[model samples]
Target: MVDSPDAFGRLWADDYPGDFLRDLAELGDRMSGRPGERRAAELVADAFRDAGAREVAVEPFEMNAWKRGSTEFGVTNPVERSFEALALPYSPSGDVHGDIVDVGHGTPEEIEAADVAGNVVVASTETPPGMDRLYHRMEKFGHAVAAGASAFVFANHKQGQLPPTGALRFDREAAVPAVGVSAETGTWLREYADRDGEVSLSVSADTVPGEGHNATGVFGPETDEEVVVLAHHDGHDIAEAALDNGCGVATVVAIARILGDIDLDTRVRVVTVGGEEVGLLGASALADTIESERMRSVVNVDGAGRYRTLRAFTHGTPAFEGVLDSVSDAASREVSVDDALHPFSDHWPFLKREVPAVQLHSVTPERGRGWGHTHADTWDKTDARNVREHGMLAALLVRELTRKSVPRPDADALAADLESRGLRPGMEAAEIWPAHWE
Candidate 1:
């Protein structure tokens, strides 16, 4: 059993996580490559210094950044009408007109059978029920590009007139224009498509060379081996980004504060990264420079504080499950464990190098991001109680990882596992498949 630190008790008595989250929300639109993102890096750096961290630095890296402009979507035929929409990141500026084609879930098979050539394709944000894995928005957009669609429309499956926004591709402009619409607008478009309606789409955006930053600081003992605790500080421009990642970085800060007062045997590195909304650019940049062999493990706090119960994706690491169990038993709280390999988050860069990693998210019945990318993702939607409770549990988990001897997965076996789970096809379609895999 892990011993609870006095600092952990102090966390329960204070709302540090929630306060940090609110502070981040006040920065306004911490989008990748934007001024807000730079301010966020500075804020995290200051917070790290205040938490008694050493060697606090804000590292900058070059990247291809996207800026949103104006977007318009309208049905030009069969009862002309206009709708509200937001341009997805990396969508090229274009004006196109074509027949509307609704590819239900935008799965590869659905796109193949729908014959979306020369038409504007509409795909849902939710995947089909009972699918083995979650189909990402980039995967659907990639399939549409391959099928020669003139434009792409991402329709949120959830109701409430909320339009979801995410990137069409990573680090570069997409082949075609893309935009997101509310469920109400999607339903109208689908019904209009049934009557052979046509639509016009115009998306204006800019893609240029830009820079992003990573705020990193180290604590614990003077050991060569270290455990990395990280969360992205970036979010989409459409919302306050409170739920998607404001809570994430806030949890990291709280953990750092608690760790500062605790005795430890291993070094702990805390990082809050930018450019996660466009891609894992900040994480990738840091991973390229770090010594992967000296790393013990990675604890990524991405979506942990969104709900009461926590979920840990172990990336097929059995040792991580044992650590989570220890935290659960010691804290007397529930932490659901899934030993699947998820290749989409900030942990992927380290996991690709054979490092054992776990991503801490919240347990939700909803399939896709419920209000994460929508305008509804505000600070008021979250609870301080959840942040305090989950922050304590994650802090314990990080401490346990530092003491445990976790073995990294073999590179060949890890690659084979990803292939066996039907992830390679989607990775390739999204142009994110590593060149070495080929």
Candidate 2:
């Protein structure tokens, strides 16, 4: 480990930046359920081998894979105009022609009040006030399905005619056809709301069983308890999935390269998960096999290198605060931590099992998932400087986590923490709240 400031600076400038960028290039356009995702997993495993890490293996698992075909969305009444749209994964392939019902923000109360039966429900991709959390796209889609809506439309909060795409949860297919449109098109659709105009949506897709794999690179001494460093190698089929996860996996590889030579007391497992865009299948599969007691902590890098600043969601693990602070101090860079409960990424599976986990993400000023899960999520949006700096911070964090003596929270305490953070309701509504919480 380059402990001295001068050595660290030299190593950062001369070595890891190119390595990080190369990893990003190797895992190009790694969309889940596609050949690119499989290749990306192999690339991750290869990176571990190239880094001289031991016990490098690729573990395969089964998942319900959905492939995108084509989508058509437009308003046939009040004002006839075709809109650009993308089909949400696992959305059934069919056609639905019905009246448009605009439920602003798609809140549960708004959905309950709207007349959604046998009509095309148009809802925002963003969460509403009093929800106090970012509701998944699937959550709004679920409300439409429950209200007997014939079709569903997720309108992106951002403008620029960028339609967002995200999948429904694992193994659960949408009963109604779902499509995503831009904020401008959504606003235009809202104008016809007072008139309850007619609209039509046509989506084409297929669901099939496929194999997904997770690449695990085990290093350091063999110990009963281990610290797992994680990032998903899979992304949506729409774009490159650069900001959401390519940055994350790149950081993981860079860290493995830097820390490969360090001899530590505890085991450090670097795992790059797949099938995360459609669902947390890879992480869930891994979580099921490993005894939760044997896992010390998980540092999941999901939305890393998107912005210049680094932020971490500690998931209310107070003990993580000191480690994050110490690492930031050592690097002379800021690593902000939000001690709230965020249950959307690969970390959720392990964290829900009461194993302490932290998700590393770059802080963005936007309210929702901006430029992510959209065609705008391209490699050009990522910066090498951000990746290198966040990589240094994350490596420092992993080192600290491996050496620090931290207590894992029990299931009861984790459930209580979720409740205290005002996240249980959203999780329950999304059908992701842990069974112990019930």
Candidate 3:
């Protein structure tokens, strides 16, 4: 009945096209589960079952999952302006009404150019503009907080869905309150930038502080040499995560379909992490639970479908490098894998635990990875063929890495691999905290 082995391989390579699309479409119906672990647990468990996984169970952990209420903002400057805004999750709230400050989001020189201290600074919801847009507007927030500013007003959401429900994080935690304004409102604030007197902004919101939970699925018990696939399922609570990671989730689903039934020679775990938006919380949690000796490799897929590149970063070891190379070779299309390395992903945690890890993302400034965390990340951006290829690559890596049959890189070997890639140390040391954080 089956055509041929080559036919199946072609299908696996995503030449069939429709397979992963169908899989992603079905996940939309399932995303309605409560913003609780049970919802993610049940949904992911269902994915495991549908994909033919066995011994599936939900590993639960305590977390603080917060929901929002009425969050609002208004302005009184050279021109009276009013609009809506929401506080980022885990943000410290306050009834902030102060002189609007324009703190350009950059280095100490930029902060020096503006009177940012004790004023409500308004900058793009993001910072550095081009360094890494995936962090949303966090760099600016962190800078303002460090500058002793009272509050911040974001300008990015002026035209889109980012006004609220956009996932937020503070690198060193936040002390002041911040909110976004409508584009028209922001223009009004911009008008007051060099005026004779200061203007007041009245912003308030209903945000609570809480931790987030991650859901993990296992096909077998843990072992000394483990293979893991990582994806973040937590979303902005606005649109279904069709591409932002519905693709990664679908890849896991597809791999589960294939790996669920195989009697494992090595441990295989498919982890759908939570709150990758806030920080690498889920990955960090997994890192804490891992035994360095048991980990072989981590294949992390985030921002799966948006970009066309097969962009990757590796904690290179002979075996791990071989695995990445093999997958890269097998791909149907020559997706651009990059030389640029970042230690700022879910993969970072695994590497910290002495597990060789790599990330699958696309559209960086250098290699041109797609916009991952922005409002533009949506279903329209997803490509069924790409999603299927991701599944194939992940499955192949898991299979090849797990064979008792396969040789793994030692811990020292893994560390050296990461070091050579220029990712282990990641960003260079900074002299002082950013100035825009309030």
**Candidate 2 overall lDDT versus native:** 0.80
lDDT of each: 0.89, 0.80, 0.56
Worst 10 residues of 2 by lDDT: 2-11
- Regions of candidate 2 where Cα sits further than 4 Å from its true position: 1-7, 14-29, 129-132, 420-422
Instruction: Score candidate 1 by lDDT.
Output: 0.89
Evaluate model 3: give its TM-score: 0.76
As for lDDT, the candidate ahead, 1 or 3, is 1
Cα error, candidate 2, residue 168 (Å): 2.0
Q: For residues 7-125, what per-residue lDDT tens digits would candidate 3 score against the true structure?
A: 22643654323454444434442221234434654567667666555566655444444444455566556566556565665455466666776665434456557778888787754
Q: Give all TM-scores, in the order shown.
A: 0.97, 0.93, 0.76
User: Which regions in candidate 1 have their CA more than 4 angstroms from the true location?
Assistant: 1-5
List pairs with backbone clashes in candidate 2: none
Tens-place lDDT per residue, model 2, 335-416, is 8888767777898899878888988988887888988888887777777778777877887888788888676767788777
